[model samples]
Target: MTSLVVVGSGIAGLTTALRAASLGAEVTVVAKAALEDTATAWAQGGIAAVTFPDDSVEDHVRDTLAASAGLGDAAAAGIVAAGGAEVIAELISHGVVFDTDSSGRFVRGLEAAHSYPRVIHAGGDATGLEIQRALSAAARAHDGIVVREHEMAADVVLDGGRARGIRLLRGGVLHADAVVLATGGAGALFAHTTNPSVATGDGLAMALRAGAAVADLEFVQFHPTVLHAPGAFLVSEAVRGEGALLVDETGHRFVLDVHPDGELAPRDVVARAIADAMAEGRQVFLDATSLRGGTAENAAFLASRFPTIDRAVRAAGIDWSAQRVPVTPAAHYLMGGVVTDLDGRTSIPGLFAAGETARTGLHGANRLASNSLLEGAVFGSRVGAAATSAPRSRGRVGPDAAGPGPLPRQAPPRADLPFSRRALQRLLWDHAGLRRDAIGLTRAAATVASWRASRPAQVADAAAAEDDNLLLVAEHLLAAAHARRGSVGAHVRSDDPFTSGKTAPLPEATLIGAPC
Candidate 1:
């Protein structure tokens, strides 16, 4: 029997392990923390899929491409869109109970950049939690899979130019015929992020160190509505879909001036708008006060429709129904990583990646809202099957065929800066966050390079290892952002004069929401 090592225990990792196990492969899942402590569990927005009769795979693919700024691979988007419903059904089989209305139809919600109300949730805003619970339970029940928690994957063990296994930071190695990387995104690279603490770009760093080609590291997606309070709690895009509005302190709906879609514009547009407002000394707020006509019924509806968000908002001493909630944009997802084909084969043989860790080109420049969950489920299954079936001696596949060739890495100028994880986060947030320009990116590159020069020769523990990985990934991200001179998708170069015009309008069908 083939042995597989799947790193990270989020939806992607767990799904890969379960699928590979079912295919008669002995699988072991390595998680940096407990299974529940993943970014998947923190996801409030539901999965996107074509479940309703009004929705079609073609429409879904079109919306995905549009959001990607025409840089996404249409074939990859079509594949994921076509596979969405089936993967959603598989989630149901794994015990993920999605929310339904009184008539037992799925309670579909709309989000920005989606042409239909196709996002399905469970436990209101607790969709990710429910899916994580179900997948964790399913993986535990399967005898063919083994779970190893607190085993941070520090590096990919490569032999003869192929992936052989993983090196655990805590000690020891887990050898396998195929190694699948599903280790979430690099949100923690920024100071404010919705990702769990373990999202230090571990998988990407491991791949880079192993000499794998990565792409699109510049297109980091900043979620537009993280609660500006202490914990950076994410306010789901569904709230806006349900008629919430984003407003400035002066009670102006500024996003409408930026784009006709108003709050429903692509995430990068909305996030940059919010960042611009914040830059101008104006605070932004998500005004759900008019949602559902702001009646007593509205409060109950919000509580019922978004129980998790309601609780968090109330805990922050804010009654969202009565007042606007303070909000800011924060790093939420990475659209690019170790480049992989549709089957999850990276440039290196025996090294596969899925979910947020892999740049599958399904999400071009910007990911359509709520597509992250679907991408994880669909591609995780594909990677699992491919890992089990692909020949061990297959040759390297090179960079992703759908996207442009990998950005050239330029050597950085010499600079000196103090280095700590906190300092690194602040550096990225200030220089590489939301809106960036050439000067800021160059400065960031220099700082990252200086830190890399001074990094410890050996990682002594998990924290140190994570810091090292963050530095390495930050270096690459800065380089990519610096190289890409034009503004596109989530990567906004403020100094790029070519894209300084008014925001482009989205399709008419996707702009079908209003604030009450």
Candidate 2:
């Protein structure tokens, strides 16, 4: 019997494991932390899909391409748009319940760049939690799937240009027919991000060392309205979708002057606008005071529709119904990763990637809001099916496998880290954050490279290994940012004047870390 190993427990990894197991393949899911610790469960804005009569797949595709700003792959976006309803049906069949109106209709919410109200939510802002709850329970109940938590996948074992399995950080290996990487994104590299602590780009570093081609590494998206407070809790874009306005200090609506859509403009536009304002020492606020309509009815509706956000803001001593909440741009998502096809096959055979770890081109220069969860469910199922079908991959026992080949070189002896995780994060946020310039990026790259050159030859412990991986990812991001001199979409270069709609020719997706 064929076996598959999946490294993650997010929507993508869980979905892939469950689907592959149902397709008669024994599956093993290894998560670096608890299953619930994934970014998926922490997602606030709901999944985007076309579930109504007024919304068409073309509409969804058009919106995605618009947000992508000529960098999106039409074919890949088409596949995701066409698969949304089917995946929604699949999620429902698996006991995932979405929020609905009193008339028993799926509650659709509006978000930035979306033409229609097609975003579906559950438990209001707790949509991700609800989906994760249902999927986690289902995976545990499935007999063909085995889940191992608290196990980190250190690297992908490659033999003769094909995937053999994964090597764990603690020193065990799981040889399998195929390996799937759903290890999320590198948001934790930034100092102020809404992502959890585990998102250190582990999968991307592992794939690069294993000879996978990664693309568009510089197109990191910054959330336009992360609450500017202690926890930096994300104020969902859905709040802006529901009549919130972006205002600077002294109640000046600055975004409307930047774009016609104002607060509803694409995320990249809104993020830069906020960043520029913050750079001027001006505070930005998301004011939804107008939504209350000065009555109990509006207040109850706001509380019911966004219970999680309402509770959070209330705890922070601010009520959205009557006050404006301070916010700032923070590192949020990566629109690039290990390059993959529509079915999630990477450059190397027997190796696949899903979720935030895979760059399937659906999100080109920027990602459409809420489309990530949709991608996770749709492409996860596709990859699971493709991995188990027809011809089973076998290991090649030749001189090629014996040679060092493209596998990661041995590290120098473990030495003390020159910078703490917090300090590294500040370096990333200051240099490679929302806005980039040639000078800052070059300086940051040199500093990181020097640190890498000074490290011990061999990895001393898991913490050292993690730091090494983060540095590798940061190097890739800085190099890509430096290469793309002109700004486009989420990659806003302060030195370049290129802006959206009037952009220069969209450059080819930056592919890196390929075997020579």
Candidate 3:
């Protein structure tokens, strides 16, 4: 029987494991933390799909391409859009319940860049948690799957350009026929991020070290309205889709001046607008008070439909029904990762990547709102089947032709290092955050290079491994951002002139850490 090792416990990882197990492969899920501790569990918006009669796969694909700003792969986007409904149906069959109207039809809602109300949720704003719960339960119940929690994948064990297993930081190797990387994104690289603390780009760094090609590492989507409070909670774009507005301190809709679509413009546009407003010393707010409409019924509906946001807002001492909530863009998603084909095959053999860790070109320069979840499901499902059925043959050489074999590691210093993860976080935020320039990128790259040089030749623990991964990932991101030199999509360069076009000229994918 073929054995597969899947890293991560997010929606993508879980789905891939379950699918692979169902196909008669013995699958083991190794996660750095418990299944619940993932960026997917923190997601507020629901999954996007063509569930309604009014919605068409063509429309979904078109909107995705438009949001991508000419950087999206049309073929990949179409696959995701067309296969979304089937994946949604599969989730439902696995006991995942979605929100429904009084008449018992699946309740669909709209989000930015979506032409139709096709985003389906469960427990209102608690959609991600719901999906996680369902997948986790299904995986746990399956007999073919084994769950390994609290274990970090220290490195990818490769043999002559082919992936064979993973090296665990705690010690031990799990040899497998295939390895699926679903380790989520590196949003936490930024100081202000909606991602959980665990999202430190470990998977991407592992792939890079093992000689896989990563593309578009610079196009990180910053959510336009993360609540600017103590906890920095995320304010879902569904709020705006439900008729809320983005207003400045003077109660003027500033997004209109930026784009005709206003609050519904692509996330990059809105985030840049919000950042511009904040840079000018103006505070941005999400005003949902009009949704109350002076009616108790409407107010109750608003509270019930977004119970999570309502509770968070109320706890923050601001009632959305009575006032506006302060918000700012926060690092949310990575649009590029380990370069992969539609089947999740990366540049290396015996290795595949799915979910946020893989760049399948579904999301180009900017991701359409709520498409993250769908991409995970669609590609996760595809890669599982493909990974299991493929023959075990010699794979193509990665950029580094040297085989990925176990190498001697140097242990991190026992004493406290001058640079800490918190300091790294602040460095990335200041230099590689929402707005970046040549000067900041250069300094950031130099600083990270120095840190990398200081890193212990060996990783002994999760902290040390993560620190090393952060430095490597930061270097790649900074390099990519520096190479782009133009403001397009999520990568906004204040130093460059803005193009007055609907899309950026097709961007060449910025590759890092690969041999010339």
The lDDT values for all models are: 0.86, 0.85, 0.85
lDDT per residue, candidate 2, 143-205, as tens digits? 999989989888887776778778887876787788999999998789999888889899898
Q: Candidate 2: where is the Cα deviation over 4 Å?
A: 295-298, 390-417, 499-516
Each candidate structure's TM-score, on Cα atoms with residue i matched to residue i, is 0.92, 0.93, 0.93
Find the candidate with the highest lDDT and give its number: 1
Alpha carbon lDDT at 364, candidate 3 = 88
Candidate 3 clash pair list: 410-457, 410-458, 411-458
lDDT of candidate 3 over 465-509, digit per residue (tens): 888888888878887888776777888888885842132222233
Model 2, global lDDT: 0.85
CA RMSD of all predictions = 7.7, 3.8, 4.5
Clashes of each: 0, 8, 3
